[model samples]
Target: MNIDEDTSAWLGCPTPLEMYKHQCAMLEDELTTAYQLLKKARANIAGLVQMNDLLATEKAAAESQLRSVSADLSRVHVQGSEMSKQIMSLKIIASQNEHLHIENQRLLLELSVLRGPRS
Candidate 1:
């Protein structure tokens, strides 16, 4: 209430109202800094999500291509087996024909011997 009392109060310590105002200003600055950090963190999370989606798409495409290549290899194996079986069948037929020709030649020689000195 007196000038001397006011001067003594200011010199010794701050009033309660003045301390409260200072604390409020400090808290406002801290809140602004926290908000800026949170915004940057959210942007980083969004970029990571997009990168994960792209990797998943590439993985699916690679799996599909692998399956297609496996199917083609299986088809080639089946065709090769069929060709081997045909080749074996042809070999058996050729052996049987050679035996028949040899038998025919022996029979013709016997017939000429039985006829004796033919004119």
Candidate 2:
């Protein structure tokens, strides 16, 4: 409780100079520990920064890919629409061909009868 320069200086056992040396050594040890902890903390911070940057970059890439996929889907839809139109046109043509075929068959039968029966 009474910390006078004379009473607490030498700690009542060691010389003043030895006490000073001991105090200096203890302070040096504490400073070294603090410095090491600061260095480790700094390294951790740097690693976290790098990780954050990588995540941001990956997010951007994913967004770009999503845009590209959306565009491709639009193109596919257009192509499908065109194919449907072509199929419809072909179906109409097939119907016309079928009608012509039936008419031709009727005409051929009539011609055979007009020419008379074969021996």
Candidate 3:
């Protein structure tokens, strides 16, 4: 019958201020949820950074140990080659000594035959 009642009846009885309050409350809830998600993401990022640092340190140590072992292996290989050369040299010397002893024994037999009448 009146203008206010007619407007309220047509607009379902909710005013502009009540609608604003309801929208504000929904925005606050969304903001709170967003803040919580941001905090968890930050914590996860920090943990990942710490893990990356630890892995880097371990990788450096492993590389260092690999280099050291490679150097030692190279030194052992050189020593083995030198030992093989020494063994060959000793074998040649022993063969020469055996040949010389045989020649001395033949020469001594010839001397004894030439001095046949010796008492």
Candidate 4:
């Protein structure tokens, strides 16, 4: 081949092979990093799944406790209602007793007046 000036100049030009090798090495590191990241992500997802199951169990327990509380409240309300009725009945009985007492006192006074010495 004849050593043309243009050919010599082009042959002396620097190719980017070194840069490409560096980039390939960087890409390999990045791929390993990504794989590690994926592994961590999978572990986190598994933990999240376990946490979700635990939360579901806790929710069921809380629901059961709420039902028990509601039943207790209902029972207490019924007992309160019965107590209120009993109080009203007692008040009525007390009023009747007061009226009877007043009548008995008035009768006693009338009897005493009639028994006054006949002058």
TM-score sort, best first: 4, 3, 2, 1
Candidate 2 local lDDT, 1-119, one digit each (tens) = 76555665355688878989999999999999999999999999999999999999999999999999999999999999999999999999999999999999999999999999998
lDDT of each: 0.89, 0.94, 0.93, 0.93
Which has the better TM-score: candidate 1, or candidate 4?
A: 4
Question: What is candidate 3's local distance difference test score?
Answer: 0.93
Q: What is every candidate's alpha-carbon RMSD to the true fold?
A: 7.7, 6.9, 6.2, 4.7
lDDT of 3 by residue, 1-119 (tens): 55554566565867889899999999999999999999999999999999999999999999999999999999999999999999999999999989999999999999989889688
Give the TM-score of each candidate: 0.52, 0.55, 0.59, 0.74
Identify the superior model by TM-score, candidate 2 or candidate 4: 4
Q: How accurate is candidate 4 locally (lDDT)?
A: 0.93
Q: Which stretches of candidate 2 lie over 4 Å from their true place?
A: 1-42
Worst 10 residues of 2 by lDDT: 2-11
Candidate 1 positional error at 57, Å: 1.4
| lDDT per residue (tens digit) for residues 1-119 in model 1 | 55555464656787889899999999999999999999999999999999999999999999999999999999999999999899899889888888888888999889889987789
**Backbone clash count for every predicted candidate, in the order shown:** 0, 0, 0, 0
